[model samples]
Target chain A: MSSLKKSFNVRCRDFIHAGEASISVQQLLKQMHIDPVLIRRIAICGYEGEMNVVMHGGDGIYCVEINTDRIVLDISDKGPGIADIAKAMEKGFSTASDEYREMGFGAGMGLPNMKKNADEMIVESEPGCGTRVRMSFIIKQSTPT
Target chain B: MVPEYISFVEKFCTGCSQCVRVCPTKTIRIRNNKAVFFDELCIGCGECTRVCPEGAVSSSISVIEPCMKDKLNVVIVSPVLYAQFPGVMPSDVLIGLNEMGFDHAIDLSYYLEMFQYAVDEFVLENRKSNNAPWPLISPICPVVIRLIVLNYPNLLDHILPLRRPVSLLGDEIREKLSHEHGVDKKDIIIYHITPCHAKVVPDRSGLMDELGFIDRALGINRIYPGLKQKLEQVKELELSLFPNEHFSFVPSTRGPLWGMSGGEIAGMRIDNVIAVSGVKETMAYLEKIEMGLFSDMEYIEFRACTEGCLGGPLTAVDRYMAKSTVQKFIKMFGIGRRLPRHKIRQLYDKGWFFSRIKPSELAGVYKSKRKPLTFDDMKKIEKLMSLIHGSDCGACGAPDCKTFAEDVVTEAADLKACFKMKE
Candidate 1:
């Protein structure tokens, strides 16, 4: 039942530092002897989630919890929350602006890509309060061929 | 052939560990007050050749001699040769090479045009094939191919199984000359004049083995002095005729551009191609590819040098200036010639484009095992990590604090080794 945890502060609109948190998490996962395939899933999920925070969220905190059995990521932001959760979760649905798109991101695929990579995803939001996303990945019994 | 393309000249080596710090593969190590290079771990990227301030590192190439009188020597020149001098054209360089003892000199761009057609058809067919891997990596750069085979063996199938243009050209020239001159193939020695040190390495094993026709590699820098002298001697000759083109040796518009960075991607006609150059950047990109981060990409062109072949450590010209010179050549006479697509397809179907990259013995040797730290070991490492400043200053001789902590656990070093902590 022992667990290891780390938290990273992600500032909104910090485009330069957008992928820094995900890269840091990736290095940490590699150091922890996690399966490479599992690490990749976490990296993609962490990256998409981190980018969402940088592009849309106000100041936010990205946290990670890992144990022998599973890995979890908790991303919470103080930004305006989505009104239609179903629509936001749609594959091509995006609220990101043209400026973000110009930076080769915000293709409306972040949330869906995150969902595809993670084993399970939970989203909670309030209209003007904030948005929080928790993603969980189960440790696989064997490496996928 | 020498076992290694690069070696440490111990007389000048100061054991500064600069090469170890920059090596992507961690092949260089400080041992007994000198640098020891592990050939098995080296990818031959020439990063060590560039970083060695004491001139301790030398890239070995076969020396050219006019004394090999029994054999007809033909030099296959890279486009980087044209980029070397300010006003010199590729034609001038080739003519000078001829004056310097070569029976004839030809450009690799000629074969590159043929190669591009092969690539276009391969990509189109590969998409429809049942199990062909997407994001086919270009195998043009030997160093990049070696890096993948040695480090990312899983992506080995992803590489385009096409013989390098230079090697393909060797086969072509040897065959054509044997028929045209009524000479034996062995009597015709085809030398590749290259800017890259990696190009000189004869494949003893692995994917690029059995390129027997490519007799030797002569470095552009090694031949610079002799070529310069020949250039002076050939100053009165008409350089505009393009002698090689008269013999049907010419390249397409994009052929010469392959010598510069981003050129291969520009030539790839496919969308979502990732072109990366320089050792460190290519290493990072390869890691991403290994992680499946670039699954959406259709192709990747990885070059070890900063600006492709033009930025190779064995080059005589500055990379920036060389790139501009190549661009100027493209503007004037770049559209030399191209074989028709049908003709190229015929060659492709004949299996001329096919090549193999065998897995390296070093592949997965270091990465397959994921060493899980015990609870006690983690606690010990955490304690050691906490005692030092978190800044990743390399004063401890390790790359960073985490590696330092890992070294402490492995009993390779101690905490007092951190000079920053001592301060």
Candidate 2:
């Protein structure tokens, strides 16, 4: 309901401090009195894409924008692009290194989780170039808890 | 304590880890590429502020800048802190504190011994009244009280009626200092050495629009540097190791533990008195309340952090170490149960001590915190939370994205606290 929008920038693919960005977006959605279901979706997808950038892309920037009617997320990477977009979307599929898997990430659930939470998700990648992800969730006016 | 009190400077803040290393509670956090204070975790020990060479970190103070006009400052420290020195007499800290700026210092816990009975009575009366809110929560901790007021308004009535430490002591300080000494209320400002910032913030806010009885709240971390420095330099007077000032004062490990987690509930020896040890545990219990579950408990001691006041952000020692310190101190001097009720009554009957100093303030449930969240609003919040998945991962600048979102919706918080919502 406020005219002003609250915002922050997430550094590309910094695994050590990865989730910090998604947490902020979830809090912003909460301030808008948006539904938890909506927040949860945004979080799942945001986290998914965020991890993807870290593991696959090396380093990338992520951005989130929230409004009463809808929530938008944009994750951009300057690292190597996705070799194959279709192969990456498969459930339980990951190209993450051994280090990433050891940290409980890169079990191939990242893309799936993002797809599950967001109402709309788009991924574009060019080999040797970076990859970008944009996701959106539509907010319902009233939902019973 | 006066020179050692916590002071904050917004400028000259460089993200340095010096203060964090020196902190006893580890309450200082570097979230969102900057320092974020975990209030529930801070004990007002003045350690971090003292260690901050740049003086960028600040805590609430009685006097503001440009007018560091020193006055006849008095302090009222809680009893638990008396456990700090194992060998010294309480008078040593008192004498040392007096030399600092207090000019006069008195123990507020002396009044608390009598008030415990009052608390017991208050709980008993509420238990007998079926109309009272079920699982009546204790109101002794100012931090918990304010947490409820700022975030959980629906459960406001559930708060038990008890005098806060500083408020009760505030009345006594005002009376003893101004009335007895022919000093004006404005002139005789009493600073309460807060265990955490919870007390420090509201005390500065004048809390609930009520005039603050205690002039300022000095945290342990904020004062640690100044006091430690003073102690090092002022070798002239051997710092007294005795913690309890009076022979009547019982400040053994058990006595000090009275303020720790589950201490009050255990003290009451009442049935259904639940003591939530940490924020996560407390939130779970609060969740039980949200499920429409009628908590039939009589007294609940809700601690925001893992260790009780001992784990406060301000203290100069680690909680486990402090607990061990307290344990060793208790073993050295056996002080088990509270002083006899009669003795407490006698102290109360006589003017030598009084308990309820005008019962000035009460902490609210939901809307009382710096940023507030409510039970009814959570449904809307859950909707938002459901969108994010249940991972409370603090990627958001806030402790969690969902909570940050709730705070923002209520206009109690900013979107900057969250990563998911960051632009």
Candidate 3:
């Protein structure tokens, strides 16, 4: 029933500081002694989400919530939102510019990769306003009674 | 239980906390003016042994001296041994060991070549099938194996299945001597001239110990003096008398280089392989790999030692000098020997080199006895963290303030231990 929450700031177009949030989250999960497979899955989703925010969104917030039974990641960005979520979810459908593409930033696999690794994923966006993504992973019962 | 390979001399320890700072696993703590090690948390990287200026940290030496008097002792010299003597060829070192009363001295390079062939074929097949994990990690360094077992269990499958060349050579030597020479298996003792203490762990733990080929591990520094004396005498002998062709074991151009960092990947035929050395570097790279990065890499060779085995804590010579000597030997002994492809293929089919490591075997090694933290525990830790100054001074015996806060909350340490609290 008890849950812990932490948040990290992600700056748009900040290639240098990208992935820092996910790395911190990964380290925290390791310290909590979570199952390595679960940690890796969460790490992949966190990384993909952070990269998405850096490339597509304006300034954003990456947050994590942890409890005995599950972990949830909420990433929200204030930028021009996607007009068609379904098309954006398709593979190889990157809207990244040539500059970002050359740097290997956007291959259009970000949302799909996150979805693949997370047990559940939800996306909400208003084209003129902003976007938010939520991902959750179920933690197996590991703590002794 | 794994044997205690590293020892702390209480008299020599100044409690300066250098070892605690250098320990990759944070297994050491300065308690009561001496360094104490938690056996379970130790990955045996020997970083403390290198950093302890007081010579407080020392690896356990060979116990085979008394037992070897009656046995047919055969020494298996690590390639790092040959690099220790700047001018002496590996054959001379073998001869020197013979003079030092060993029945036979075998160079590990022969088995290193065999290991390379097997790995090459295995990589090729795995590439074609794409069934196994990509970027298979080298299993040569026991410390690296232990690190994966403790910290990165998810990457356990990334370790190559082949038995380490030393283990393979130990088995082959024991079998050959007992079967062909008619020596009793119990009487034929195998002493590994080890460059590091980590090599001592595998002989006692995991799948590497199932065969029980190696009887003991002798540090290079321990045996250097006697070998050097014999080498001085052997150096005077005519080069033509013990020519390269006359020696039973001669390494190929690439085999001896295996003791150097990046040497393993250098010999591999694959193009997408990477080689990383040093504990910190390996750990950082592993973090990246766990994040699902480097998908295109076919292989990765990681050595816990900075300059590979030559820079091991037990070595007597400077790592840079040893590296140069290894290079000189390779140049002198240009392209010496090769295992026939057919022979390697046959052994590969028989699964002769495969060694499986089960992560389940290492289950409790890294586990904490305390129960998982609850919401209240987290809130308490966060509050304590805010109260403490964030300077990571090791005066509290913990690695950093964050660890100190966790320890205090877990009842592992007292809040009074924080020197800053008194001020």
Candidate 4:
């Protein structure tokens, strides 16, 4: 098989289970016996995406595709999209309300952290049309078994 | 290596997956109408033994026989044994242990007290350096150590590297007995009387191999009948062997407390500590620690058994009664110290209280063992998963629907095994 995909539903402001999706994805990759380094990257970026959906998105779907050579994460949400993707991509530029701040999150590091951790990142948003963030990580070349 | 303390009896197992569901490591799986164990992944926590309705799981506890010519037998009693028999005096147990044909029976409470001191000093040293990871995890529970070594390698650095109290006591007793008897060190056999099954696994480090300090570890359940008989004998004779310091090491007031949950932290006098018991709760705590949730915490004590060592599968008494008995015993005698802090400090500074284990090297092997899921297999698994009812009811002899689906796709299970599918 070329690839396998799994999708998770992220409800907005569900702080009770904020990182549940990322954990599930992480566990799945672990069960697959992926390299620890790759699993760590996936966990960090996936959790950042999951937290973003719970904190900012009205509703979202987090999809992970695992391929022989690479893994892909696509986070799409129905919410007030970022008008200036460039500005929101900067570190410490979050627009989170006081409640989010009180929960020790929304420091504006989510997008930047994801971008820094992933091999490549893509962002698209239409202010009111919602936003979609996609990230791809190259599976490190392995010595042939 | 994963220890072989807990054995699965295939004949008695019904493939209920009760042990599978309760296994924190997910090492037990149902295949061919039987529960199979991945020994490398098992931590020997005895959770399987606890949940096996068919009585299929049993632990390999040590059984000490009488010493032959030139062999010196010494029994190192578990601190938890004091809590095993209700209304039984601590001295009575020691006397009973002696009556079992062992030359000497030593209480571990003294070693436990020393261990507490060592722990406090180690934590304080870490606090001063501020270099080690936060929330230093306790390594007293062999099962917890195995869990971390197998599953949580990253947190290995956070585990306090001290040797178990019993190991230290084993070393000391062997040396003392050999010297006093003018006998070869090999002639002295030290057997640890234990309440936990995990203790039966030999400490296979080079030092342990060389010294053979603790030759065997026997569960209290194995000796409880003999001990009960001995206790009756002592009561009938009205033996006046209280504080048998001449015959054996009397436990200091605080060490036996290590038998219960939170006892280690309380004994160490640590200010900020979180004590969690039971395999599930310990695993959850570990996950949270992995997520950096307990960064502000100082210490975490994770015991595999529900009520700590007292709740071990090999333990003879109910956990609550044991806890109360321990408390009452401590109250009746009150607290006393066998050695001064300065002496404990001397031992700590001499580096005699810690394990020489290179945790990363030893535990690092358990990683990279997860089987890779092929893309074709993944698709089939996903398709099968989607077709199944998502209740995760575990009625199909697998832990959940997803696992059952995977098993079916892999030809390890049949599709008709699903009740919903039959409907």
TM-score of chain A of 3: 0.96
Using all chains and alpha carbons, the TM-scores for the candidates as numbered come to: 0.84, 0.54, 0.93, 0.85
**Chain B TM (all candidates):** 0.86, 0.66, 0.93, 0.90
lDDT of 3 by residue, A106-142 (tens): 7888888988999999999989788999999998887
lDDT for position B214 in model 4 = 76
Query: lDDT value for candidate 2?
Result: 0.57
Per-residue C-alpha lDDT of model 1 across residues B285-360, encoded as one tens digit per residue:
7766654567667778889898798898888878998888888877886454456778888888988788744333
- Which candidate tops DockQ? 3
- lDDT score for residue A112 of model 1: 90
Off by over 4 Å in 2: A1-145, B1-71, B203-211, B225-255, B292-294, B335-423
Query: For residue B417, what is the lDDT in candidate 3?
Result: 87
Error of 2 at A16 (Å): 30
In order, candidate lDDTs are: 0.74, 0.57, 0.80, 0.77
- lDDT of residue B369 for candidate 4: 53
- Sorted on DockQ, best first, the list reads 3, 4, 1, 2
Go through the candidates in order and give each one's DockQ.
Answer: 0.23, 0.02, 0.57, 0.37
Better of 1 and 3 by DockQ: 3
Fnat, model 4, is 0.44
- Write the residue-wise lDDT of candidate 2 on B189-262 in tens digits: 76766556456454321232223676666666555555555554445666455433432243334446555677
